[model samples]
Target: MTKRPPALVAIVIYKTFSALLLVVMAIALGLTVKKHQLLVDFSESYALEGKLQIIKWTLKEILNLNPKTLQFTSMAVGLYAIVTAIEGIGLWYQKAWAKILVLVLVGISIPPEIFELIRRMSLLKLAVFLVNLAVFWYLLRHSLSTRDDNQLQ
Candidate 1:
């Protein structure tokens, strides 16, 4: 059997990381739902502010069983993660659809990356932005080159 190329390997790793992050987020959400007081105590202890307040407010709604916003958000996150994982698996198998899916995802992420750079101008954030740009460029170039190869064959 032929070994996968480096680009494919990179996508597999990215997908695995996304899947793991989703699982961790899901578990944390569950814990927050089950033990609201735990979250409350932690927040109170830390004297959290700003974005922390926003997260706390969101969690409060979830804890109170206000299903609309929380349910929608959870569903969206779950679907996105699952779709991304599927695309990753497909890319590992060198499927054309996966290449398109990845490009689309990368496109969608650009705005948020820009927003992050504007919000926090730090070396760490710049490094992250540059890394993402590199990943996006590498994947795009690989996908296009592969497509060209197929056309010439």
Candidate 2:
């Protein structure tokens, strides 16, 4: 078995975590929509008792969501989450296709990230952009190295 690279492991962990969060959010939102009355009742009770004002606001926001719109949003997030998960798994296995996928996906996003930074520069934004660029570079460089290693063998 090939030893997994630390970078690949880190990417897999990050992607899996993000996918998990998105999936959880989608499920929570779906359930909240399905049990809208329950959430509304709880929110009303909280407001009447003047307890956990923040929760009341949050519940109100959630309760106000249109089920159709919520479903669409949830589905979109779920799909992206699935894609991220697949990429992570592929990277973990050091698949050549995964490297290309990572490079293309990350490369495509570079423009948007740069635009965001140009629109409003922030430390967090810069860090995210740099990390994404690094990931792309890593994938490209490592893929070449692995290809060369295979050829030598």
RMSD of each: 5.0, 3.3
Over 4 Å off, model 1: 41-68, 122-128
Provide the global lDDT of candidate 1 against the true structure: 0.73
Candidates' lDDT values, in order? Answer: 0.73, 0.82
**TM-scores of the models, in the order given:** 0.71, 0.73
Model 2 Cα lDDT, one tens digit per residue, 37-128: 77777766634575667876787677788878777877887787788888888888877887888789889999999999999999999988
Against the true structure, whose TM-score is highest?
A: 2
lDDT of 1 at 81: 76
Task: In model 2, state the lDDT of residue 126.
Answer: 100
In model 1, what is the error at residue 108, expressed in angstroms? 1.3
Where does the lowest 10-residue lDDT sum fall in candidate 1? 66-75
Model 1 over residues 1-153: C-alpha lDDT tens digits?
568888678768877787778766666565555566676676566455555667778756666764354445566677777887897788788787887887788778878988988987889778756766776787799878877998999
